[model samples]
Target: MEDFKELTKAEEQIMKELWEMERGFVKEIIDRLPKPKPAYNTVSTIVRILETKGFVTHESFGKSHQYSPKISKEEYKKGLTGKLLTNYFDNSPKSMLSYFLEENRLDVRELDEILSIIERNK
Candidate 1:
């Protein structure tokens, strides 16, 4: 996990597709994408990068490959948040929460619900 590197936007886009599919071959992934899907070589290159990052792996089945996530979605999300905090929030959860609460435009009712969640957790 320590060896894992943050994904670029292009890599993240491909990863989102793999996350949704749970597992998929190259063609399946490309077909699932919206318009302007990445070229086969581009997607393949990103997939290999994910593999090197330890986020994904593939099983060999004859001539085709069945790719699957090596890490759970939750784990990947945690990694993303860690990056966000370190890069954008100066690693301060307080600052991040402050910015998010003020900038995200949550209504009062939504804020109350979120507060309730925090209270319940406590």
Candidate 2:
């Protein structure tokens, strides 16, 4: 598997659109964005940056390019989670889970559901 470089906020936004559409032109991506929308050139530039970073690829249709994500959302999320676990939790899953439980004030049912998931995974 290729190591994914972290995306800038703008790049991530563009990526989300590509992931949703599977593939699209710049106008299609911009149309899906929330208001206030970014400029067309701004999105175009970010998509190009994502291509350079190996996260996106484009198909050419005459003068137009349709972009798609090379990396899946789950893959990106896993990489980001690993980085967060290492940097903020000292690579300790226990510490991370403890922090989440303490900070979020999750109900007993939520905790039970989490435990069930852990048990199933194990």
lDDT of every predicted structure (CA atoms): 0.85, 0.89
- lDDT for each residue of candidate 1 in 31-90, tens digit (9 for 90 to 100): 987887779888888888899889899999998788988887788788888888888898
Pairs in clash, predicted candidate 1? none
> What TM-score fits each model?
0.85, 0.91
Candidate 1 wrong stretches, greater than 4 Å: 1-4
Best by lDDT: 2
lDDT of 1 at 34: 85
Task: Name the top TM-score candidate.
Answer: 2
What does the lDDT come to for candidate 1? 0.85
